[model samples]
Target: LWRVCFRRKLRPRQVTGDTTYGTVENIVAVEDAGIQAFFPLPDFDRRTPFFGKGTFTYDPGADAYRCPQGQLLPRRKTKYTEEEVLYQADSTTCNTCPVKAECTKSDHGRMVHRSFYADYLDKVQGYHETEAYQKAMRKRKVWVEPLFAEAKEWHGLRRLRLRGLLNANIQGLLIAAGQNLKRLLAAGRRHAPCGSLLALLREPWRLSAVYG
Candidate 1:
């Protein structure tokens, strides 16, 4: 949808979502599609570490990460199954470090994993810590949640009655139309001649025809 919008010159300024859509993959995807996305960091990524990955800094020159213990964790191997590169500390260095026990249980010292696109993922995490990202996330929670609640509770859109893509889309549009008509009527009632508003509310079916 975003791509289609972009091609049609209807580019969206930004997209915001909650934690569920905050995966590294999704954030990278959103950014790749040329939209700024605001999402909280995923729980797995946000876990407090024994010695956090931040303790290991990357060196582009050597293409390796330097551990807190001053040991260089060079690229050990790449996993074919997962698009990740693993870097490991020398066993001798880890075995000799006074804080080895605090750092890693591995015989080969400590290992850190980096995604092929870890740079993009890290960029997303960086943006997540910004004040603007936080404000956008709060707005997302405030605006999107109520519509889902309203659809489920009042419009019976909690379960689908229709099958197939076409029918399901039609049902969704109809549900949205119903919700919009309700909002319009409520607004009208607030300002319309008093008795007429009551009459309109008493006969909401008339709204279906007008909305359609």
Candidate 2:
């Protein structure tokens, strides 16, 4: 469906036992907000079975690719994609290729996905490699995550307040308000009684029960 409008208001994406609703939120504080808006990558290590082009082996010093026989395999041909650069081996040579059975089942020959953006992703990975994001994400554990265990384990509250949309909305608002109060009390921030409500609207997780 086409979106008639975009509202940053906290809309329920999922309701966990009248406790939480994960929301898509935006904060103006981030500098490169647009590019960093999306998920980073599908995986962590990112080294694929098909080596990315420009990807070096354990021994590039050896003139050729160390084939299964550990012999030097010549670079037969290179190819291009809409996305990135690529390289390939000779299909005719692959027919008699000793490691053909182990290397690939493809009668065509083994092909590798070459990404020009691999270095970009590597930098992003290196950012995560540091102690930073982990440290920041830890703040999420304080309230909402433990609140969930309390709701689920102690109260047996595993679902929403009511079936119809109106009832669900009411339940959500109440939970958000409760969470706001919890944060204000816990932090001892300089805030008046209504100030907590304002802060809840500013930060998303404040409206949800758990830190996660």
Candidate 3:
């Protein structure tokens, strides 16, 4: 989609999606293309009882995280498999701290993993607090989701019959075309005048003749 947009010289202001499309890679790619990505960040930390990752403040200049208790967690190691750098608090400091119980139960103290693309993720996350983001999300819910729902439920897109990537793309395009044609016909009917309806009913052969 971004390639097509670039080729056509279409400069979109923003892109919107659900959490499924909110990966760090996607956020970075869209933002690097100079478009705002309005999507919810997938926060798995929210399910934890301890202080969530959001509680930590990132200091880009220091390349460290400031904990809720004001302790700086310095970069410990990079987990290349996860594409993140781990920042960890000193275990001795955490063990003696007043907020240890609230922070973590791990013997190794509190740790926060910052994605290599965290800067972009931070920008995208900040967009969640904006009016434009809210408006875009609302529009996506009403304008975009229903088309996907219709395609999956009514257009046999729940599972693809084709075996290859190219075939699947073709099937999806055909389904979308069919969906668009349905909407176009419905719109035409709604806009047709009573006289036109009567004429079509009286001379059904005219419809066949015109279409043919």
Identify the leading candidate in terms of lDDT. Answer: 3
Task: Tell me the tens digit of each residue's lDDT in model 1 across 1-212.
Answer: 46557566777766777778877778777888888877666544247545777678998799899988778999999997798899998889888999887777778678898888888767777887788888887766666667767787988779989889777778778887887678667767777565656666686544432211
Error of 2 at 79 (Å): 10
Best candidate (score: TM-score)? 3
Give Cα-based local distance difference scores for all models: 0.75, 0.45, 0.81
Q: How much is the lDDT of residue 41 in candidate 1? A: 63
**Candidate 1: what lDDT?**
0.75
TM-scores of the models, in the order given: 0.74, 0.39, 0.82
How many clashes does each candidate structure show, in the order listed?
A: 0, 6, 0
Which regions of candidate 2 deviate over 4 angstroms?
1-40, 44-82, 96-98, 137-175, 182-212
For model 1, give the 10-residue run with minimal summed lDDT.
203-212
Q: Order the candidates by TM-score, highest first.
A: 3, 1, 2
Report how far residue 58 has shifted in candidate 3, in Å.
Answer: 2.2
Candidate 1 is scored at a TM of: 0.74
